[model samples]
Target: MSKEVAAQFDELAALYEDMASWPFRHDIETPSVIAALGDLHGLDVLDFGCGSGLYSRLLKRSGARSVVGYDLADGMLGYARRRAEKEGLDIEFVSELQPRFAGRFDVVLSVYVLPYATSVRELGEMCGALAGLLRPGGRLVALPIHPDYQPDPDYYQAYGFRLIPDDDHDRPPRSDGARIRLELCHGRYQASVHAWYWSRATLEAALREAGMTDLVWRDPSTASDPAAAAPLLRAYLDRPHAALILARKA
Candidate 1:
């Protein structure tokens, strides 16, 4: 299933620019994240699962001292390399993992990679490796599926998962009243993998277990907007969407 997902993205490289920068819609949550990140001056960043190098370029333009992007898709990497070249940006594209990168970065950003992990164990390993790559006091920012939008079909298919409206940051649980459609990309190869959702409590627990603390969770901008409906929030949360999580290395 993992291999097939990568293959699909490898084939998607040619169309990635259009898909990523499309005016009306896009699969990845680039705008939500970039807005959340704010500024990146003098930061040394490692972009984990940086597809098509969109965020990588943004980081450089934000004045990052150095930016390196890693991804499983060659097609994305090719476009990334070319874009970097044409723009004269000195971003590094590493297609494979390197031991030397351990503890080398001031910040690590994983935009949309967590859902691909088939299990919690795998997710732990992925997070652990990313944590190991961070320097002490360095930050790691990630976007994952909001747990409210994700319910186990085996358990919640009857009621379609709990839905409740929320407005507060910590006081309110995820706005569950909305019905969001999550389109699993590699459904043909793998039984449709929706979302391995995790609540704020669940996320904090996992990060603490990995020896990370000071976790900060923020709602996607679209979610906080009073104008957005529950279903749209759910769509923003589930679709190639991202939950911005920031934590520091202890």
Candidate 2:
């Protein structure tokens, strides 16, 4: 993905909450994560890839001592800071990923960030940065766009409304009938194409290469139940939502 498209999200930041409607809450997947993370009271927390600070607000209500919001998009961070100020919630907004976090946070929440990474090396570096910043025993809880959902064109537009998925990379031909659409929709009449499909094994391998362990994968309930899929598409189209990956720094 281009940095240009990443910039688009920031532009949409101000109206994101309203445009999403009330039920489009990112916290739809947050509660289960927090529960698995255990205690939050008085613990310092970081909302990595914090978008519009919705989860940051949720963290405050859950009793975190201090919650800092970080994101790559300035527009999102702008909204976060404004929301913090208006609500009398003190949240430190870091507009870009720094070499290291200045203070130790007990919990780090990285939701829907990995898929946007440009490469496997980039993903590894991100994990390394998080690992280096975490306090010993502090957990790094993240939700990755399941490689399964990579084929959907809507996923590409979500990253940048104008961009299309690149399919020039070489890969082996599939022996099965599995396929995912990369439909690019623009308003009611305009639409185009984008690349679709990433394998589950590749995703797991990336995590392993990043040195992440204690891996536990939970398919989001809203995404679709694992047992509900036919065997052919089970690895890719079986899940449509986020994949909860709880990995330890060590």
Candidate 3:
């Protein structure tokens, strides 16, 4: 990830935490991620790019034996440490992912991390780094902008967010490494950040080259009870901006 990307997210530290309870995340994103995690019981998990430690706390609460939240943004890590402490969770939050952590986790989970890669080489390095963090046969559960992402900035507006290509003229980005703008908003909270685009073919190639295999893609699903469902989330789920990629170290 670029220093600029990390710096941008660092500014969203507080707003990032508030997003945990935002409708889109609460009803859609988290459930899909947790389901992809599939039985965290007694597992040692790494919450990669864990902004404000949301998933880190969730993984621990889900019965993971230990959860370590790692991120390049010191702002996010500091806020995460504070949140984890305030909530009395024993999760460890770190600003670095050093060699000492290689092959040390049972699972490495990331939410909205891969898109930060500004180039194919960076993407491959990212995949390799995450792969190295895992032990033999360990899994990686990641979220990246779906290759089929909607180009209309307003398409997801009703779902508390919007996306638009970061181009001089508002045209859709058709190549890898093109920048995109992501804006998240709730009643009175709003934040925006830039992320790169990576196609499915490019992504899979990176994973495979990183020594990861058994790739699977899962669409977003609700954690809400059907009877208590909110209707508008359907369109977003059908064409989620991001998707889950599950794989294992080969």
Candidate 4:
């Protein structure tokens, strides 16, 4: 992680737990991520880019034999550690991937993390790391910001959040793309953060280079159970928000 990016997360660490519960995450992203990663019983799972170990706890509760959460931010890791201790959940949270972890997990889950790759090379490196951590036949499921995502005014109004481009530019001219400011107000708390965007082709190429195959672009609606995620599904169908990537290590 770049110093700038890491600093941003460090500052947001305290607010992240609440932010993680944003309707889009709890209602949409989480369900999609879980559905894409079906049947965790006795599986060794890793929550890549896990912030505050939210999904790590979920994976443990869902019956993963062992769950490890990895992230670059110390503040987030601190929160994760405290949460795990308080909840009495046996989860290992680490800031770096140890050598012993290579080829050890049955599944790797990443939600809303890929876009942090500011460049194509960086994106490929991240993908390579994910592939390295998974054993042969191990699956990777990730939910990244959609490449074609454009903020809709109505959707923002309905969702109680706001997405504002850094500038008036419709698209970024540089290879790294532009940043967008995301602001959310839930009850008395309010928070804002900047997020990057990358092209879909760039992501696909990175996955291929990482030796992952059978890449499938899943529709967000199909990524979750309809009955349980009706509002999220409806919102996704109304306007595409995030993209689900399912790939396997060969």
Clashes of each: 1, 2, 0, 0
Q: How close is each model in CA RMSD to the real structure?
A: 8.4, 6.3, 1.9, 3.0
Q: Where does the lowest 10-residue lDDT sum fall in candidate 3?
A: 167-176
TM-score per candidate: 0.71, 0.70, 0.94, 0.87
Tell me, by TM-score, which candidate is best. 3
* Candidate 1 local lDDT, 12-112, one digit each (tens): 55444554543213322556677666677888898998778887988898899999999888888988899899999999998765687988988888876
Q: For residues 1-250, what per-residue lDDT tens digits would candidate 2 score against the true structure?
A: 3355357466556455553332212323444565666678998888887879887877887899988888878888888889889999878888655555743878888876665555556656666666665676677777764544444444444322232344444333221112222332334323333222334565556656655567777654423454664443343334344567776655
lDDT (10s digit) by residue, model 4, range 128-216: 99999999999999877776665653466445566666645667522245666667666765777666676678888899999999999
Per-residue alpha-carbon lDDT of model 3 for 2-31, expressed as tens digits? 667788888678887787777778888888
lDDT of each: 0.64, 0.59, 0.87, 0.78
Best by lDDT: 3
State the displacement of the C-alpha of residue 248, model 4, in Å, after optimal TM-score superposition. 0.6
* TM-score (C-alpha) between model 2 and the true structure: 0.70
Best of the two (2, 3) by TM-score? 3
Return the lDDT, model 3, position 102: 81
Error of 4 at 184 (Å): 2.8
Candidates 2 and 4 compared by TM-score, better number: 4
| Model 1 spans > 4 angstroms off | 1-5, 22-29, 150-202, 222-241
Candidate 1 Cα RMSD after full superposition onto the native fold (Å): 8.4
Task: Sort by TM-score, best first.
Answer: 3, 4, 1, 2
